[model samples]
Target: MNLPNILTLSRIVAIPVIIFLFLTGNPVAQWFAFALYVIAAITDFFDGALARRMNAVSPLGRMLDPIADKLLVGALLIAFAFAGSFTTGLTWAAIAIMMREIAVSGLREHLGSEGVTVHVTAIAKYKTMTQLIALGAMLVVPLVPGLELAAHGLVWLAAVLTVYTGVEYFMKAWPHLSGAKV
Candidate 1:
């Protein structure tokens, strides 16, 4: 495996440790989780850049990159939800985000099988950025003053972007989504 793929795999390896740290309920553990998360998030950017710069992109990296991202983001969201980080009535926002992720993933897989490619959109990249920022803040909410509010705002913003991107992806792939392949 190349450096980029190794970095991607490292992210996948770090998810459970991050979740463990968050679950421990200690401030130090939370900080550790936050650090791990930030490192992982940074790797997401570098792996892609390195892959392109070094001409080392592979089908395996393409498949595992998103899986690693989903694992990291999904674990953080579920942990935060369990910790009651979301608003009283806004838990559905998290659910909506998760549902959209799964739907889009499934849609992408279905299309891939049909010889159709679904590319990442600029909006979706923004959604990822907001999501990582939101989740990072949420993970470290106790460490910073007034950050919980900011974290919630980021989450809401990410949700809006997520929904919009989901719609955009659906519309773009609607032609392929139809027919017996769907």
Candidate 2:
């Protein structure tokens, strides 16, 4: 495997390590979890860049990259909710984020099958950035004052962006869906 693929796979591998650390119930272990999450998130950025720069992009990397991201984000969100750390708003935010993820993934798959491609937009990148920061903040709750509230606010913001992006995608695919030229 290329370095980019290795990095992508590393992000997936980091998920279990993060969960184990979070389950340790040690405050220090939570910090370790945060560190691993940061590393994995960083890999998400570097992997794509490396793939492009090295001309090592592959179908497997394309498939694994997004899967790794969704798994990491979903695992952390569900873990937070299961740990009873989420406020009601945060819970709703998490639900919306997860729901949007499922919806967008399906839409993208259908569009891809139709040979309709939608490029990732700035808003989409922002959504991911906000999510990573917000989740990391939530992970270090005691360390960050009022982080639960802050993280929930961020999650809500991300959810809005996520929904908007999904809608944009659907709008882009609408022509093809309607049997019109894309």
Candidate 3:
């Protein structure tokens, strides 16, 4: 496999380790998980960029990259939910993000099968970057008490973007979904 593809694979492989470490109830392990997660998130950006830069993009990489992203974000959010990392009011934010991911994925798959491509929008890229940053802040709250409020704010921000992008994607897919000409 090429380096870009390898990087994408590494992110998927890191999912379980990150969740396990974060769930260990130990500060050191949690920090380790956060560090690993940061690395994985960075790779998420670089993998696609490197693939394009090196002309190493492939079908396998294209398929696996988004899957890896969804897994890393969704799995960690669930782990955090189980760990009671989110307050009752904030839990809905996490749920919203996860639900949007699921819905968008299904929409993308359905459209792909119909020979229609839905490109990732710039706002969606910002949404993902905000999500990773928000999660990173949330994960390190135990190590840095000052980050708690900021972390919560970031989560809310990410949720807003999640919903907005979800609606945007749905609107774009609606005409196609209704079997009307694009």
Candidate 4:
């Protein structure tokens, strides 16, 4: 119920609007969607900082934050794929990033049952940054020439980092994943 949590919930609430804008098929809508996405991504950073500064962290916020992130990123990637924005290697790269997210989330949930928490790493944070930048570029690609290529490159980079971080998390959690109980 604090500001940070409010911001996090706002990100979740904005998802439907973002989706609507993306589906509108207008250049203006695409710009609006890109702005919304950038705002959401900024909140992802500020919310955590506010939570830490205000000491208002809650289990619900902890749970909701990552889910919101995943939902936003996944929805954008799927939307782009459906819209044919990913005509080249970007589609597979997006798929790879999405798969890593799913795998890591599942692994984290399983590990949580064993009282083991898998903290987000610096590399994971970097991957998220690249993904957001890539997604933002893709959203606005139509408005700018040659930006789509940059977006694709960013996505590919993010995909590689996503896979690397996914492997890192899995390896770190392997012992707990081996039928260990809390």
Candidate 5:
């Protein structure tokens, strides 16, 4: 009910609209989607900050924030893959990122159920930023013809970070998974 939670919810709401915009294959609609995405991403950052500042953090916010993030990123990645927006040979990068997301989410849930807490590492935060930047760059590729190389580069870079953080998270949970003492 607070502003922070509202912001988190807004991102989930924006996903379908954004995807529909991309599907239209209209430059203007895509640009609108890009704009909406930028706004949604900004809300991602602010929701947590505002929650802390206002002393209004709630379990609902906690549960929804990460879900919102995964949905937004996952949906955009899938949209780009299906739209063939990624450069040939670069679609694997998108697959890698999506795989990492799913793997890590499953890991977290498993650990949580086992009374183990796995925190978000600093590097993972950077991975998220890189992913958002790469996705944003990809959104502009059609409208900005010369951006293909840069967009593809960003996607590759994001994929590397995604895999790295994913491994780091997995290693952190290795002991628990192996039933060894933590």
Candidate 6:
């Protein structure tokens, strides 16, 4: 119920509206979707900082923040995957990214059940940032010619990082998973 938690919830709420805008296929609607996405991404930063600064942190805020981020990126990635401006290569890259996200989420949940914690690495944070940028630029490709190619490059970069981070997380959980070192 605090401001920090509310901002985190707002990010999730924005996803369906972004989907609606993208589905419209109008140039203005796509652009508005990109704007809304940027706003949502910016709120990720503010919400965390505000929670610390205002001492408004709560269990709900911590739990919802990452979920909001994942949902936003996942939704935008899927939209770009099926959208006309996306390339065949971008679709494959999107598929890889989504797979990695899902695998890591499941792995984390299993580890959490075992009382094992996995921390987000610096590269993973960069991957998230690159993903957000790639999706945002891809959204604008319909309005700006030749931008789809750039977005494709960004997607590939994110894909590489995504795979790397997923592998790193897997390694972290390996011993616990096998019960050899726990």
Largest lDDT belongs to which candidate?
A: 3
TM-scores of all candidate predictions against the true structure: 0.95, 0.93, 0.98, 0.94, 0.97, 0.93
lDDT by residue (14-123, candidate 2, tens digit) is 99899889867798988899899899999999999999999999999998988898899899999988888787877888888898888888987887887767677888
Task: Compose the digit string of candidate 4's lDDT tens values, residues 11-39.
Answer: 99988888789878898987888889899
How well does candidate 2 score on lDDT at residue 134?
80
Candidate 3 per-residue C-alpha lDDT over 1-182 given as tens digits, one digit per residue, 9 for 90 to 100: 99999999999999999999999989999999999999999999999999999999999999999899899889988988999989986799989999999999999999999998999999999999999999999889878878999999999999999999999999989999997877
* C-alpha lDDT (0 to 100) for residue 167 of candidate 3: 98
lDDT of 6 by residue, 1-182 (tens): 98888888999999999989988999898889889989988898899899999998887897788788889888887776666555677777778888889899899888888887778788888888887787777777788887867877887998898889988889878898887967
**Model 1 regions more than 4 Å off:** 180-182
If ranked by TM-score, best first, what sequence of candidates would result?
3, 5, 1, 4, 2, 6
**Candidate 2, which ten residues in sequence have the lowest lDDT sum?**
142-151
What value does the lDDT take at residue 146 in candidate 1? 80
Where is model 6 more than 4 Å wrong at Cα?
none
Q: For candidate 5, report its TM-score.
A: 0.97
Once fitted onto the true fold, the runs of candidate 2 whose alpha carbons sit more than 4 angstroms away are none
Between 4 and 5, whose lDDT is larger? 5
Q: Count the backbone clashes (under 3 Å) in each candidate.
A: 0, 0, 0, 0, 0, 0
Q: Report every candidate's CA lDDT.
A: 0.88, 0.85, 0.93, 0.87, 0.91, 0.84
Q: List the residue pairs that clash in candidate 5.
A: none
What candidate 5 gets wrong by more than 4 Å, as runs, is none
Query: Pairs clashing in candidate 3?
Result: none
